[model samples]
Target: MTVTATRSRAGVLTGVLTAALVCTGLMAGIFFAFTVSVMPGLHETDDRTFVTAMRGINAAIENGLFGLVFVGALGFTGLAAVLLARSGRRAAAWWAGAAAVLYLLVLILTMGVEVPLNDQLARAGDDFARARHDFEGVWVPVNDLRTVLTALALACLGPALAKRTAGVSR
Candidate 1:
């Protein structure tokens, strides 16, 4: 490759990697917040209050800014994987690939498990007791799993970013 083209690729990759890191970090932070604060605080509330508060949170989370970061983390990580592999940076590729897979799992868990549960609870309307009974036990465990996955994904991306930076500096 020409020097200019190589520099261009490096520049784009730096942006992608930076986005991957920030987005994954933010996503992980969200899960951490829920785990350490939101859920625990919800635990102290009554059934109706818990159900209502959770419903609001679920609804609020589907906005534009959240959507951008949520999907951005996945997209950038996946791109980083392909780019690293193409450049024969196998170790960095593997790290980024793992990050992609783990983050994708987070998406799957959210869509397949969490969203449906949230929807059901929101539609429960006056059935707050039933909602709390059905949602809390199942949802909490799955959310915890996603939280761990996000954190792991970020960990993988950290190594990938370091490797990418080293390459560029060289």
Candidate 2:
């Protein structure tokens, strides 16, 4: 490829990688906030209040903006990996690939574990104590796992973006 073509491709890769990083960072931040503050604060509340708050949060978080960032993190990271590999930036590609895999795990865990718990909480009737009992133990731990995974994904992307920016192809 010509120098100009290569530069253009690299620029596009940079944009995609940047988007991936931003989205991943946002995901990590959200989970981290929940881990540190939201859950803990809610933990101090009564059972019914906790269940009501969680149900509200689950419903509110299902909007378009949240969905875009949540899904886009994985999409852009995977695309960045593929593009880097195709361009022979092997090391950066590997880092981005690892990030993609990590974020994919986060997605899988969210859908497989957390979402089901959320659904159960929503279906939970007037027995707020029972709902909180079932939800908090499982959801908190799983969310903590998600938070760690997302942070790891962000960490992996950092090196990838740095290597790309420094023009380190190998």
Candidate 3:
């Protein structure tokens, strides 16, 4: 390929990767912060209002099928990165690939472990004690996976951004 054509392709790939990284990074941060800061407090309080909120929150977290969306996004982001890398954006590709792997593993933990536990919790119905027990035992670490995946995405974004800069310079 001509030098100009190669440069143009790289630029486009870099732009797409940058946009994806920024968006995914923002989502990860928002999710992690909400899960960490707010979800915890929901568990700490046991007043009627707190219990109501917890039940509502649990339903929202589980029944909304958020994980399906999350999984889809993760797949798209990884595919984009692969395309970018194949087109010559190695750094961005590497970052996205790493983040994708981490996300996949975390998602697996969510589906295989957390979701079933959520089912158990939901079955507890108005039995707050049983629900809380199940949540504490299983949900906390699943939530921890959320935080870890977010951090992974954030970390990957840094390298992806650097690659964009380097690609522009080259």
Candidate 4:
């Protein structure tokens, strides 16, 4: 390949990796906030208030902006891994790959556990106590797990981005 083409490809890879890092960090922050602040604050509220607030949050968080970052973290990280591997930066690629896997786990837990619980809460009628009982027990722990996974994913991306930069410098 021509020198210009190689440089262009590297630049694109860098952009994708940077995006992956940002999205992953944003996701981590979100989950961390829920873990440290939101859930705990809600936990102190009355059962009816907790159920109402959680249901509202679940509804509000389904917007386009959130979805972009939610899905983008995985997509960009996976693409960066493929691009880095293709460019012969295997070590960096592996790191990116690991980030992708970690984020995938977060996604799996969200879909498999969190979403269903949220749905049940939404349909829970006026039995706020029972709804809170059913939801909080499962949701809080799963969200904590997601928080950790997303943080780990963000951590992996740091080294991957650093390695990519070092490769460029070399």
Residue 140 of model 3 has an lDDT of 72
Per-model TM-score, in order, reads 0.95, 0.96, 0.74, 0.96
> What is residue 31's positional error in candidate 4, in angstroms?
0.3
List the lowest-lDDT window of 10 residues for candidate 3. 161-170
lDDT by residue for model 1 over 1-170, one digit each (tens)? Answer: 89999899989988998899999999999998998899989989999899989988998998999999999999999999998888777788889999999999999999999989998898887888888999999998888998999999999998998887554321
RMSD of each: 2.2, 1.2, 3.7, 1.9
Q: What is the C-alpha lDDT of each candidate?
A: 0.91, 0.95, 0.66, 0.94
Per-residue lDDT tens digits of candidate 3, residues 82-131?
Answer: 77566566776777788777767766776788677666765766777656
Q: Mind sharing the TM-score for model 1?
A: 0.95
Q: After superposition, how far is residue 58 of candidate 1 from its true place, in Å?
A: 1.0
* Per-residue lDDT of candidate 4, residues 1-170 (tens digit): 89999889889989999999999999999999999999999999999999999999999999999999999999999999998888778889889999999999999998999999999999999998999999999999999999999999999999899888555321
Model 3's TM-score against the true structure: 0.74
lDDT of 1 at 144: 90
Candidate ranking under lDDT, highest first, comes to 2, 4, 1, 3
Q: How many backbone clashes does every candidate have?
A: 0, 0, 0, 0
| lDDT, residue 6, candidate 2 | 79
Candidate 2 wrongly placed segments (more than 4 Å): 165-170
